[model samples]
Target: MKAMLEGLEYAPEDNAAATTAATAETVGYAFSSDHLRALERDGYVVVDDLISQDVARAAAASARAMYDRGVMQNLRQEGRDDDVAVLATSSLPAGDEFAGLRPCVEALLRVPDDLRRVVARVDDDALGADVVSKVRACRAPDRLMLARYGSESCRYVPHLDNDPSDDANDAGSPGLRPSDRVFTLIAYLNPDWDATRGGRFRAYRPGVAADAASPSDFVDIDPILGRVVVFDAAKLLHEVRPSFHDRYAVTVWTRGAELLPA
Candidate 1:
């Protein structure tokens, strides 16, 4: 279990650590204080080479195998009329499509260890140290999922993932924080990538203007191998540009708990 992270420079705190316990294994990528501040203000931060090249390759290989088996479920944009995007789909860990993805999913869930540390810095008295544990126990399905973008036409338009009106939200459940998906972690497993290849992930600045129809300013991040993007989905707006090449990655959402009744 060696990490192959060369040619990538990061702060001392940016280095990742992993440990296996008797019951569960814990692997976390540490974010510097500066990075935490950026996330607090900008709503997103891209951590370079958070995992070893071998680990990323393994996740990608497993994902590709599952895709070849035709086990993943196709997902389309809420209002789109285009045909199903085989590459633009997700596979849940507990489902049949996840038979070969267990190890990768397990590694992904461990990311919460680092995420909890970051969240603890935000209003610690309010969120508390157990926020991550409580979130893991919530009724919401917070399973690890594989999101693949394989087609040139497959694109995700600018939108919030937790918008109540969206049919893909919490199965239309009505309750406190029905759309309270607190954070999102996307670990890129692609081997080779470039901006010209498309499938760039973009994050917009907050408070653009309520009257404005769309966000104007944003930062685009290339989905390079071993790069992990963490963002607060409840506050930031983002989307995936149409991808010309097949892309594979593991995505997980941290569900926020409701403190009071709706």
Candidate 2:
């Protein structure tokens, strides 16, 4: 197998030093040294207010429109009200219904260059430390937006983003090898969410279960808009609890680069 990243720009002698130094000087929402250390140790970290209210509202509006249109066939078939939950895998909806959300997705992805830079820095650090780097040459996915309507029936069961089975070699999903994910970034777009509203993201730590572990090892962050939670995608097992009210957010996952056929 050939290395997934061959012509990429990460080099320790020259580029890594410059990247590390440049990251240290920037001023914005960032993970503290202590927090970074914690993440390195426990596999996750959370930064509050990563997105602004204007951006959150725009994304929310777009999500709501998409939900109303019944883009997610799974949710509509259950006869659940539109507000219950919405999940957008790639980009924003394109029709007139989701026109407003296009800008919202673009703005959300582009607004925090500094934050994006920090994440890149962290990705580089993970690479250097021999941590599994899942997605190479990718900053973050455009958006994995979700909007939950006022219903408790739309709960996401606990699960890991990556396949955990060791028998992947024998599985039919060719070219897709089993991998241990290193990081996940989740940003909440709902400003009014709280513990009482439910739908709080619950995580269980490693070793908590013989079969399934949770992501709440070191921290349990509430679903607050502008809050970005970065955690070990493998060790941090998590689930979205049901919500009595509406809930909205954008989620992104990062993993170590996968082995590719030569």
* Model 2 superposed RMSD (Cα): 9.2
Off by over 4 Å in 2: 1-32, 75-91, 95-138, 142-150, 166-182, 210-219, 255-262
Kindly report which residue pairs in candidate 1 clash with one another: 87-148
Please provide, for model 2 over 88-119, each residue's C-alpha lDDT reduced to its tens digit, 9 standing for 90 to 100. 32423445545544434443333223333444
- Per-candidate TM equals 0.67, 0.62
Residues forming the 10-long window of minimal summed lDDT in candidate 2? 1-10
Best by TM-score: 1
* Candidate 2 global TM-score: 0.62
Least accurate 10 contiguous residues by lDDT in model 1:
1-10
Candidate 1, residues 1-262: lDDT per residue as tens digits? Answer: 0121111221111221232132233333445545655666787778874566776776777677666756566654462222321221123323333343444444445554555455555555443333334433332223446667775656677777667676656664432233756667788878888876788887888765333535357878888887888776666778787888887777766555352233
The Cα error of candidate 2 at residue 91, in Å, is 5.5
lDDT of 2 at 248: 65
